[model samples]
Target: MSAVTDNLGLFFGGYLRSLSICLWALVGSLVLGVLVAACRVSPVPPLRAFGAFWVTTFRNTPLSVVLFFCAFGLPELGINRSFFFFGVLGLVLYTSAFVCEAVRSGINSVSAGQAEAARSIGLNFSQGLRYVVLPQALRTVVPPLGSVIIAMFKNSAVVGAFGVGGDLWSTGQTLTSARGLETLPVFVGIAFFYLMITLPAGAILQIVERKVAIAR
Candidate 1:
């Protein structure tokens, strides 16, 4: 308890930063994912190819490798920056691929007739996707999308290994080292802290999904 209480402000503050990183990363991932998913399902060959390329490249690559590249590569390109920015960037670029696939799966679930009927009504691919396909696709995908967001939130811990100071993981280490405390309590606290974030997010998604389903 002392290990956490000794620096109460530090723990809570770092937790906030971690949440902020996750929030920013989630937004970035969803935007990029939707675009990539669009390309994957697009009628144009090149568009589909580009989307496939994106999914393959990111999905296959390890997050640590991408993080190292961003953390190191940015400086080589003369964009000296903090680990927080790089961490968020790495999370977004890597997780967006999974988001793309989940969304693509949802798009796939929509009946072929939906799209065909849409086309018969003079709706083009992009317009039909926006007005018709996306609405239904989103309903099916909410749960999986929520899971992805939670996974990405947990992934923020990886950045702590790289010495990003204002995150929960690093803060845990900071408290442990500075207070000369045992590691177990610190880690357990960290785990509970993460659960606090993920559980509520999952609940919110479920509530929103249920509401949407009821409305539809």
Candidate 2:
């Protein structure tokens, strides 16, 4: 009991650091996702092609591979990291590709008539999308987006394989190595930490979905 209590602070500090990275990754992914969705839906062939390529490439590639490329390969190309920025960057870009598909599906769920009605009211395409279309689409996508964020948060642990410090899994490894403790407690602690992040996010998404349904 004393051992567990003794290491609790260390465990929590690492969990919080990882959570912060996850939150930043979530925001970055959402913004990039919105842009990619726009590109996918655009009438221009080049834009559509670019979006398709991005989504396919990133979605199909493994997350760890992407992290390795960005964290290690990028440094060779002159990109340096002050902290664990590259790990977060990799999570953002890789996860954003998946988010883009989710957002695009939500956009498709909005009927063409909605856009047409906005256009008939004298709104331009961009204006209609910004005001009428995207709001609805975003509302519809909140649940899925939340799921993506939770998954991204969990997966952030994988960065530990690349020597990224101060994350939950990395902390577990450090603790286990130092104390020669059994793996079960360390992993259980990690799972609890992840649940702390995912559950609230899931509840918030459910609330947003209900609100959107009411608005509709």
Tens digit per residue, CA lDDT, model 2, 79-142: 8884478888899899999899999998899999999999999998778888988998987787
- The candidate that wins on lDDT is 1
Scored by CA lDDT, what does every candidate get?
0.89, 0.85
Count the clashes in each prediction: 0, 0
Colliding pairs, model 1: none
TM-scores, all models, native as reference:
0.94, 0.93
Q: Compared to the true structure, candidate 1 yields what TM-score?
A: 0.94
Pairs that collide, model 2: none
Candidate 2, lDDT over the whole model: 0.85
